[model samples]
Target: MQPDQEVPPRVRPGPLRWIAYAMGAGLPERHRTWVLYDTTTRTWVWRHVVRTFVQLAVPIALVLLLVPGAFWIRAMAALGGLILGMAFSLAYMTEAVENRVKKAGYAPGSAQAVRDLAGREREALDSERRRAAAAKRAVRYRDRRNR
Candidate 1:
């Protein structure tokens, strides 16, 4: 609270603000904007889709240029490229999201922490339900004894 203490400077928002937001970055009021997909997973999936397309297209283009192949050959190469790109993207998605989260100033495994918390909450709710059922049965037995 001392006037002599220097305040930390605010970060200037960048082009990847939406991705950063998905990765748990706090947005400044000035930089907050409308987004079509609200959740981080949705935005990340969309990004992955785009990246997969780009990856597939680039390799296909290179193959067509360098291979001097018949139409069927080029088409097969394109198919292979698509398959490979999809497989790579599937493997890469988790790493990509984690990197984005890190860039957004979150600790690595923050997403996992959230999942673990949710699991604990579910277990607690289940335990409470079981306790409530036991209590109800106990009350029913006591009432029957008094009948």
Candidate 2:
């Protein structure tokens, strides 16, 4: 991305809307940019984890309350289910985010494209800083060796 490329405005959904979104509902058009940013940002993975937990919350509670078992047994079963759900959810997180972007009316692979661009920009900056630091170290090493 160019240094001056205009980022889309980030309009987050309200609490109700966010709950709906976490349950697989598409957000309104006004939040499309936020949707993309949310899926591709540095904290995107953690964001997904939170959403996954939210998605599972009700079911886990229900299992604990309604299942015929001791309290401890119910909790252990819920924990196992939660762990399995998280593992499966993590495996398809990227695809899930992309589906969300598409649901918000973007083309396929849009989230991946944004993530790739951000990664490239980060790498470029890291490379520049590394080169400058390496040059300074080289000069210091040469002076010390001569002395």
Candidate 3:
């Protein structure tokens, strides 16, 4: 081939192409039981962090209202109460992770589709290589016969 010869049209796997497929395969759409639990727990924990403030504040505020003036001490108790409330939340979160692992198995149609696509891609690449090799062989045969 000449130095300036244009490269043949071949599929060169690029990072973007590979990542697009990977992104498609790694969707958060189909949640297994375990995955559902784990994901829910993580989400709930964040929500609870916000809720705990409101939950602890009302009772603490009431007590402070009844008492003369114990704002600082009540604030400390409220912080501690928040920690106590988190125990149950953490337990549920642990359960969710466990459920996810328990129900953790291959996805329904996703795995099969990925496998089929990969197989087709490989077959296409193989065919291209075979065609190129055959062309090279034909050129070599003609050169030898000419000599």
Candidate 4:
């Protein structure tokens, strides 16, 4: 392929890669392609949620197993673990999202960058509209003067 024609990087999809990404590892160049970034971010977040749930549940389950307890006790333990895990996850959701963004080869402040880009696009569109309107007015004035 020609140098000007850039080829997209190849991303390796697997459990190990997923685990690494969940632990906040940086994304590889192949994974940094814009087309794949969104999907990768979503998958990373989903995996992180599952990992968090499993991480929180295992110890609670083991501890509850060791303790001689009623059915209600075990149930409550599981419920509490779930709630605690969810709370912690919610508390760190922003960080998780930002991590995913960074892993996908974007800056943490890329949301603001996106907003700035959109603002520039809007300004350009508005300028084009104004120019079109002015051109129409100029044409109309010229037509009236000729008649």
Candidate 5:
């Protein structure tokens, strides 16, 4: 390496660093909560849960609201309703968490510690996903052996 050559500048980390790490590690599908630090003492938080069953209830409710003659339209309306419901629910969750963080007397995503915490959360989620996958594979192997 030539000493005179200028080295590329390192990218400064931000509140979204943990999300990038999780996506990079191939654990984006895993459900986890993430905290974000904006420029305040407190960080932002996000969590994914197995809410499919709960979310599905919206579609079912829509189906129940349909009248008898318009079958196709009923089905379409149900699908659209389900989608809209989920979209609004997600938006509400994000806003609520941000408000909570703000009320906690800290600015969201401001501190170095918050950034590190987000990274740690991503790592923990990645590890959990790997463990679950391994367990699933072990069960499948054992079932095959029994067969």
Candidate 6:
């Protein structure tokens, strides 16, 4: 790609923005590319898991701090909340991610669409490579037989 046409780095939201994002807020339109990248990258699942943890963090912390109980009781309460929260978050992982992508000004399912397109492109390239390799093998075998 030409230097002038190079893509800029996706803008990562700051901590506050990230917290808002974990709470289901859509990022600003300028962050559209970042939102797509965040949802469609190879590590997207990990990103989702981390976001889920972030979503649970505040409530869990509050439970540990404010709810009157023994230390073990508070810890147990926080643990239960974390487990239940993660379960729900992961259950709707794809939908939640798609929602974020849509909020970034893209159409619904845009993240999955982008991921699907990339997978197809990769499959095409792999098929081309396999065909080339088979042709090379056939030519090598024919040349050896003739010799």
Candidate lDDT values, in order = 0.61, 0.95, 0.51, 0.67, 0.50, 0.90
The residue pairs found clashing in candidate 3 are 34-99, 34-100, 35-100
Instruction: Give the Cα error of residue 61 in candidate 3, in Å.
Output: 59
> In model 2, what lDDT does residue 39 have?
95
lDDT of 4: 0.67
Give the top-scoring candidate (lDDT).
Answer: 2
lDDT by residue for model 1 over 40-138, one digit each (tens)? Answer: 432546765665575466577888778886988988888887888788877877676555455545578664455457668889999999999999999
lDDT of 2 by residue, 1-147 (tens): 478998678899999999999999998888998998899999999999999999999999999999997999999999999999999999999999999999998899999998999999999999999999999999999999999
Residue-wise C-alpha lDDT for candidate 6, range 30-130, written one tens digit per residue: 77789899999978999999989988889999998999979899999899999999899889999999998888888998899888998899899999999
Q: Which ten residues in a row are the worst by lDDT in model 6?
A: 1-10
| After superposition, candidate 4 runs with Cα above 4 Å error | 1-7, 10-12, 23-29, 33-48, 64-68, 103-105, 111-147
Candidates 3 and 5 compared by TM-score, better number: 5
Local distance difference test, candidate 2: 0.95
TM-score of 4: 0.48
Candidate 1: the clashing residue pairs are: none
Give residue 106's lDDT in candidate 3 (0 to 100). 35
Q: Model 1: residues >4 Å from true position, as ranges?
A: 1-39, 111-147
lDDT of 3 at 123: 95
Clashing pairs in 2: none
